[model samples]
Target chain A: MFDIHLDFDLLEKCNRCGACYDICPSCLNIDGYDPRAVIKDILNGNAGRWLTSVHIYQCLECHHCLEICYQNYGFENAMTAMRLRAARQGIHPPQVRRGWDMFVKTSRLGEPSLAARKKLGLPEPRESGKEEFLKLLEVYRMRRHGPSPCLRER
Target chain B: MKEFAVFWGCTIQARFPFLEKSVRVVLKGMNLPFRDMDGFTCCPEKSLVNNIDHGLWLLTAARNISLVDKEAVDLVSPCTGCVSNLATAKGEILSNPRKEGEINSLLKEVGREFKGTSRLYHLVPFFHDEVGIQKIKQSIKRDFSGMRFAVHYGCHMMRPSHSLKNDDPLEPKKFDNLIRALGGESVEYSTKLMCCGQGLDRVDQHDRALQMARVKLRELKNTGVDAMALCCPSCFLQFDNNQHLMEKEGERFNVPVLYLTDLMGLAMGYTPQALGLDGHRVDTEPFLKKWKEISSRPSAAAAFSEGMKKEGSFI
Candidate 1:
C-alpha cells in the first residue's frame, strides 16, 4: 500500500544502448545473466518477462551505468523503483527480503565495523563507550517499527 | 582566505572527528576560510529509508542548504551521505521542476524555503577536480613511490545526480590518479568496483558482508597492493573494518585502508595522528609504520622525483 508512481518519461530515457549491460559489475562478475535484456523487456511493456531473469538481483545498485550514460538517466533509481513496484506483488527474489532484513537491523546501509580499526588495535564506538552508538541503534529500531514505542524503553 | 561553509553532517561531529581534523589542517595549510553550520540536525537520510513521514530530511537538508545558499559559496562536506543528500537535493530542485515545489512545500512547514539554486560539493570531487590534482602533487613533501593502492569510490559519490564527477563508477579510478599524483601507485582491484556491503552490515548478514569483502580482498591481495584508498566514509568502514573478520574466517588479506584525504595529508608531511589514520578501526599502524620508515629515509624523496609513476611501476 505504498503510494508508488511510475515515471515513464524517466523510464524511456534508457536508449536500450546496452551501456548498462556492458559495464554492469553484476553481469560481468556473474554468468548467463544480462541487465540490458531486462530493460528491453520492461521497455517493451512485457514486465512479466523480468520475473524470469536472475539479473535483477545481481545489481549492486552501484550507479555505474548512470555514470557513462549521455542522458544522465537515473538507471539505478529506475531499477530500484521498478523493483519496489514488483516487490509489492511478491514477484521479487528471496535475496531482496533478506537484504531488507539486514538493512532494518543495522540502520546503516553499509558495514558495521572496519576490520583495520580492530586489527590496528583501534577501539570501536562500543568499546569507547560512546552513548551515540546505542542511541543510533535504538533510534533505528524505533524508526523501523513506525512510531509504536521508543525502542530504548523496550 | 578562501571562504566555504563547513557542512558537518551527523557522522563527522558525532562519529568521525578525525576527518574533521584532517580537513581543518588541509584547509588551514592552504589558508581556506570555513564556518561550521551549527544547529543542523541529521540530514535525515536515516529516516527516509525507514519511511518516516516527517519532513525532517528535506527540512534539514534545505535548512542547511538555505543557510549556505545565503553565503553563496560552495558547500563543503566531509560525510559522503551528506554530500550525496545535499547534491541530490540540488539536482532534484534543478532537474525536476515539480520536485522543487514539493520540497519547498515541505520546507515551508519548517519555516524555510529553498530557492532551488545552490551548489554542493563532496570533499573527494572537490579535492580531485577543484583542488587540482597537480596542486596536491606539488604540495607533497613525501613520496609514496612503491606503494600500490586500490581506490574505493563510495556509491553516493557516483552519478544519477551530478556534483561528484570525473570518474566512471564501473571504471572508477580518478582517485587512483590522485593517489598517483601524490606519489603513490594506484592499483585496480576487485572490491575496487563493489559496494562495501554497507547496508547489509546493519542487518546481521555478517556472512554476506564477509563474502563481499573476501571476494574484493582476494582480488586485491593477488594484485599485491600495499593499501586501499577510499573517498567515502562508508567504504572506509567496510574495507578497513571487515578485513580482520574476513581473515579470521579464513580469508587472509592484510591490506591497509587509507582515506584519500589522509593519504594527501600524509604526502603533505602531516604526521600519522594529524591525518586521523590512527582513529581508523583498521590497524593502519603496520602500514603507517612501514610508510614512515620508507619515507624517513633520506633517499625516499628521490623515488618519485622522476615524476608520477603509473600503477605496477616502481621508481
Candidate 2:
C-alpha cells in the first residue's frame, strides 16, 4: 500500500510565508498559479479540489522554493503530495499515464535508437536492465496486493 | 580521477545521441576515467516517477546506484536529473537503514544490493572540481575570449542543496567559473538563475512551456548573447528544440543553444560536424560565424592605436 503524508508543521509556516512565490517560475509567470492558495486548501483538508486542476503539474520541480524556504520544506512538497494522490486515483495527465506505462513495461521512457546509433557511427548500446526491473515490479505489486497465491509458490 | 561510469540517462541516448557524442568527445579529449556500464535504467526522471510513486522512485534510483556500488566505481552523468535523482535516493537510503534494508531485500533476488558508498557527480561540477580549471585552460586549442554566453544552470544541478551540496543552490558560480575558464564571458542577466520550465512540457502543458522558454530566451536575445550554454538534455529540448519550433512559426529568437560539452569540444579543436553541432534544430552558424570573425580581426583598441600612429596624431 502507498502512504503519503505532508508535514503540516512546516506547511503551517509555509502558509504564512510568501517568500518562494516570487521566485518559483510557475508562480511568477503562469496566470493564477499560486501554491499558497493550494496550501491553504490543503491545510483546511480541501486538497481534493486541486485533484482536477492543471496547476499541480506546473510546479516544475525546480526546487527553487526548497532553497528559499526557511524550513527547507518548500511548497514543492505539497505539490508533489497532491500529484501522488491524483495519480493514485488515475486522475493524472495523459502524458503521465503514457510515461508511467513505458517505465513499468520497459524500465525506461525511451530506448536507444539502434538506427540512429548506426548513422552516428556510435557503438551498439549496452544491454538494458528491463527484465530485472519488471521482475522487481512484479514483486512490488504482489507485496502491495497482499499475499497472492502464485507469488507464494515462487 | 577514480574510474567511473557515465550515466547517459534515457534522453540523450534515445533522442539526443548527438549530445552524448559531444560529451564523449570532450571526455576522451580530457582523458577522463569514464566507462560504460551495463544494466542501468532511467534515472526515472523525478517529476514523472516521483510524483506517481515515491517508493518506486526511491527504489529504482537506489537500484541504479547499487550497480555503481557493485562495480566499486563512482557515477558521473551529463544529465542533471539523473545525478540528482540518484544522489537523493542514495542520501535517503543511507540515512534510513530500515528503508535501505527493505529495498536491498527486493534487490537481493536480482543479485544487487544498495551499499550507497559510490559518489555521484554531474559533469559540470566534475569538470569544475576534479578536472581543474588550470588543466582545462591548458587543454583547449582555442578560447571564447570575445564571445558572450548566457549560462543556464539547470535547476537540478544545484538545488535542494541539502541533497546535492554540489554548489550554491540559489546563486551557483561553478558553471560561470567553467565558462570563464574556457575564456567566455558568462553574461549576467536578470533571469540568469531562473528555471527553464522544461517540466511544463512533460505534463502536456506545451503553451506554458513555450511561455517559460520565451521569458529567458527573450532576455538573452535582448541582451545580445551569442548563445545559451547549458548541461541538461531536457533544457536543451526546451530551448533548442522548442525554440526551433517557435521560429518555424515565424517568431524568431535566434539564440543558439550549446551544451557545455559542445563548447568544450569546439575549444579542443573538434569540428562542428564531429561534435554533432549540426544536429541542433537551431542553427549555430551565426554564433560560429561571429566568433570566427571576431577572433580573426585585430583588436579595436589596437586598431585605434595603429590608425593614430598612421595619421601622425600627437599631442
Each model's iRMS: 8.6, 1.5
Q: Score the docking of each candidate (DockQ).
A: 0.12, 0.72
Each prediction's whole-model lDDT (CA): 0.60, 0.90
What digit string (tens of lDDT, one per residue) describes model 1 on residues B1-315? 246776655455445657656677776665556665533444535213312222233434555576667666667786777777766656545566775676565555444567745557777767777778777777888878767778777777655346555356456556667777888877765456666655445434455556666667778878887788876666666777778666566666778887777877787888887667667766787777778777676464565653446444655
Tens digits of per-residue lDDT for model 2 on B13-78?
999999998998999998888999899988888888889998889878988998999999999999
> Quality of candidate 2's docking, in CAPRI categories?
medium
Root-mean-square deviation of every model = 8.3, 2.3
In TM-score terms, candidate 2 sits at: 0.96
Model 1's chain B TM-score? Answer: 0.84
Model number with the top TM-score: 2
Error of 2 at B170 (Å): 0.5
